[model samples]
Target: MLALPNYPGDGGGLIVDRAADAPRYEYASLNDCPQVHPDSPNEESTCQHALRDCPPEELGPLLRIWRRTVAGDVVLEPWDSKGLTCASDVAPGARPTLTMADLKAQFMRTPWAKPQVSSQPKGNITLVNLTTFYRVDWSTGGFAPGEVDQSVLRGIPVRIRPKLVGFTYVFGDGTTYGPTVSTGGVYPKGDITHVYRERGEFPTRVLTTFGADFSLDGTRWDPIPSTVTVPGPVTTITVREAQAVLVNH
Candidate 1:
């Protein structure tokens, strides 16, 4: 008699008796043996051949049955190459791919420096005949053009390089200035200057826009499709009209 242990969820073991006049083989579940089709004329022969040559290594969730001979010594049957399959045969999903859009999203989330607005006349300024020279204090939170941010997404290494493209100055009082590439300098030579029409307290700020490039291998770099604009903290400037009175010396 040959005994095949049933797979999990298959109720009973299969028993084949060779001693009978016509050898009889009882199957527990037809679903467990996929090779045995009901429409096939030689289904029984195919099932028998499949069982005899089932590879043990390919035994997984569905094909975990073990064949053994129930005789004087109860010997284990050697497995061969046949119709069994394991989970490894199933196709896997596509690998993760990086794009320019993905890198731009990451660059926007990076902790970039917030610009600090500086004026030549400090806090208070005279409105008449005075031009407030505006500049960005790059001493502390300055732009690092060559700085690179690195990360790994689904085993793909990505490096992003941030570059300061332009600056926009908001001189409050309904006035706004350019997306110019100038960082603006101090006093006489400074290009970014604002003259207030009337005397009052005004709130001012600077907007910094950054463009970026990304790389997968560090050697080859590609530009990102978009740029990020960061706004700086507000700086209040008090503009007062200067009045002169003649006094005895």
Candidate 2:
């Protein structure tokens, strides 16, 4: 609306005629018609321009109740830790409309909570490693407190833990003796030698068999009842008299 140029101080010129919605409109709307911008002095300084509706974070009904609607096209991944999230964007006019049993009941409150994964049961417990090598015989033989004289052996480097998978028992109590080894889970660790044809004190033990189906950190990685106390009376020496008792001691 611009057309006004005819004024000469009332007696020299007069010819003006403007009328077509002058000063009609321009720029405005910070929420003016939220119902008359209720007392908005700074309510985002709104002016109003035919308010263009709101709500839309997916299917806006307040973000579709924190989004969790499940049905056909599925895919919405977020919470991860090998738990795999899934929710493939797809929201449209949602208002109490989510099938698939409401997406399996919101994936059981997601967190991989499917009854804690059917009450734990994963698998893996390895700690039975012993190979075998012996020729131990410093001299004679005649001492059986709890006999295991399978035959003078030698190859010491023992190290076994609750690995899990069969046999597991070793004992020597005197401060815990040492040499009744027999780890399992298909052994593959190392070290095994027991040759004390004349030992005095012995007390070593280590047993295993915590297998009744477990997995949840296996009831706390249980397995620790070790013992070893073997030190004394070994005067057999005969590998050339134990190399002359290690070169005359």
Candidate 3:
């Protein structure tokens, strides 16, 4: 018996049950070609023999789905002779045209390392005055936007870049800051500074949200709906009550 996994998209591929008397389905590997001979590579396997006489249209979907299913685990080179030979029989433009979404999906398969975040204190100490304005050294955050031209399918160059969209700040008090744009405030300058009603130690951290855009065929970049959030280093701030006193020396 043969079946296809219900992939999220239109892509689907054949899952064959090798056991003659029983039926069980498992995710098929790219090298597990049922159509090819097991012992002799050239000899016709049961599946290859069956597909050889089948109509050309029926094979297109199977090939496409098979390509997408194991994309992250495998990299298919352009010089793959057998794959190219089978693909050539399909009509030109019969395969789905790759879009920005598809390109983004493909990019997501790669493992990208997260950038480091730096938090600095502005005042003399982490301590802040409850009655006065509070400030902390601000940074633009890491993973700043930059463009990269990547050679995609058929050697077409794709232009892609990342953008810092917003940030989620946790004050560590009972309250939380926003998906805000301000990069916090420096000493003597309070932009997104906060004042605590009481005094104690508060651990603060920020989660930065980054969005991406890509351009195919070197055209104008179009936004991709997906976004990645990276956590910033945690910073602890202490609030101290200040009092005024007069003395004569």
Candidate 4:
């Protein structure tokens, strides 16, 4: 039996840093992806194959990803042009993941590769209709930010459980100051006034989760940042919320 689980010492060929631009750095396994080292008999490919083109039985357990090629790119196959299926592609045994990459790299096959990935929140607006105006004081309750994105979304599903997260309003003076504001969270009831000392593009964003989300094990934190290019002296202003990130490499 061609071992159902991963080939003993590897977690699918070092995983190839799925986030990396280049393919896996090495290949030397019996079930290696084919496209990688097809000609070199002993040269085994990475998981690119088992994940993309192999059968469910061949793919022991890591079948969750479904061998998606790429998010926004076209796959090609020059082997088709050669009429020999390209000597360097599809050998006896190869890494399914790397094979998938080669197929895409050839730029001769499918234009849009397949990807069975997870889902995230969509964008929409709604109004917050209060049950009792007297009981729900305007001071204690302000509209929480109502939005989400890949940079701050979780691996789990919100439909299964709610997430504890919210948003904060950024003023133009590079600080958050208090101003009587009204918002309906995910929905919008009417217009609310948030005072920014300057007039500019203050980035506005929100969180779909209320900080008590069941999707994540740890804190679902999102450093919603923005660059508000405020104009001189004007009570009513605009702002651009951007997460200023500094990478030290």
Candidate 5:
């Protein structure tokens, strides 16, 4: 009887007991094993016969075994054809490969915060030619300077950290401000202010871009060769012409 260790989600281990008079079969890899045809008349009989008679040595290192019950008989099959890896092929302490493409895909899937748009003069309305001071409300998920996400890939621990590259402010009405690293400050001192040339309603928002770094098995950090851009929620600013009126003192 030989017990094979199961892969991550296999549920339980598989115990194989060879019969005394069973025929011996050799297969260099799991791909060489007979594929079960669902509609074949001898489906179970053909594959089961091969599995039962084949020795573990001939099958290479088995990472997972799939067990299926057919007509009150237990039948075993390989979990995945590409899942098998010989123990000798993997070097000890070798890190699992994390490519830039993989990192970019993961970074795109991250639930990053949208830019929180805030403006001075404190309302939806501002005057034409007035410098409408704008800034990202950092407390409301404006930017993530050093955000990290951790996960396990190919049985190895991995870490990914994202750095904010810049912000692109779109003050609708066909005007755009940045790719600027500045988060733009407040009221009197805000660097990201926009002056409305002609008064009307302008839809405004910010886009944040990020570049990332990754680490494997808790090793030193390395940069990922890509960047991801996330768009912020839109906020409308209504600009109108200010008319002066005479008042009695």
Candidate 6:
């Protein structure tokens, strides 16, 4: 015999009938939800639920979990996905207090926008005989640089800022490069350039990782100590073989 109590609200539970060699799930008072029974091995009824749309009061321990889950601040279970909450399956007093990291994550609803990358020949065709210089313009996103804001976390006011750290370029040719600096380089000679060995079309991409810092009282800034990486738009380049021939009169 097993029993569990729902958190913040007595609306869910799980009962295991050892004698019956089966498991039973019950949601006590939630939306008149019915008890869940597993019919086959493939069928499982865990406390998984969506919390993004749930009322703030009903979130309980789940609020912290959902916030961390959405921000990629926590290690996700194999089954966790967008708008899905498996933390509900755990009993109360089983969750950790929301840390400064969790607070920052919740504040950022969307990741920092992609760094605007500008380079020569921003299209198909790269000369295999010459080096392709690539440059990135970091001033595309609307986030304020070194900007700070105050917000409340669990009733306590906090300050946070999102800072761009670096960029990683996936050349899409079985090789990758660039956790490079965000500052764009001079034309024909850039710091983030790449070269192709063979002639073929390749899809290239750049991923940017942002680090954050937070302060509890709008004073000393403490690093969140975690970086979030988001993929930028894809740009395809075609490399072709070419040669410069000598001309005679």
lDDT of each: 0.58, 0.22, 0.45, 0.25, 0.58, 0.50
As a TM-score, model 3 comes out at 0.47
How well is each residue in 133-225 modelled by candidate 5, as lDDT tens digits? 888855344336576788754344567777888999999888898889988877778898889889888888899898877765445666665
Candidate 6: C-alpha lDDT: 0.50
Q: Name the lDDT value of residue 205 in candidate 5.
A: 86
What does candidate 1 score on TM?
A: 0.58
Among all candidates shown, the one with the greatest TM-score: 1
Estimate the TM-score of every prediction.
0.58, 0.16, 0.47, 0.18, 0.58, 0.52
The 10-residue segment of model 2 with minimum total lDDT is 113-122
Error of 2 at 137 (Å): 28
Q: In candidate 4, where is summed lDDT lowest over 10 consecutive residues?
A: 113-122
Every candidate's CA RMSD:
17.4, 27.9, 14.2, 21.7, 15.1, 15.8
Q: Give the Å shift of residue 107 in candidate 6.
A: 5.8
- Per-residue lDDT tens digits for candidate 2, residues 94-211, read 1232122222232222221000000000121111221112211111342212211121111211111222222222223122222333321222332333333332333322332221
Instruction: Please tell me which model should have the higher TM-score, number 2 or number 3.
Output: 3
Clashing pairs in 3: 35-48
Model 4 residue 73 CA deviation (Å) reads: 58
Worst 10 residues of 6 by lDDT: 63-72
> Candidate 6 regions off by >4 Å?
1-98, 107-110, 122-124, 139-145, 149-151, 182-184, 243-249
lDDT of 6 by residue, 143-243 (tens): 54466656665454566677777778787788778676545465555666777888888777778877776665455565654577777777777888887
Residue pairs with backbone atoms closer than 3 Å in model 1 (clashes): none
Q: For model 6, what is the error of residue 196's alpha carbon versus the real structure, in angstroms, after optimal superposition?
A: 0.6
Question: Higher TM-score: candidate 1 or 6?
Answer: 1
* Steric overlap count per candidate: 0, 37, 1, 54, 0, 0
- The regions of model 5 sitting more than 4 angstroms off are 1-98, 138-143, 217-219
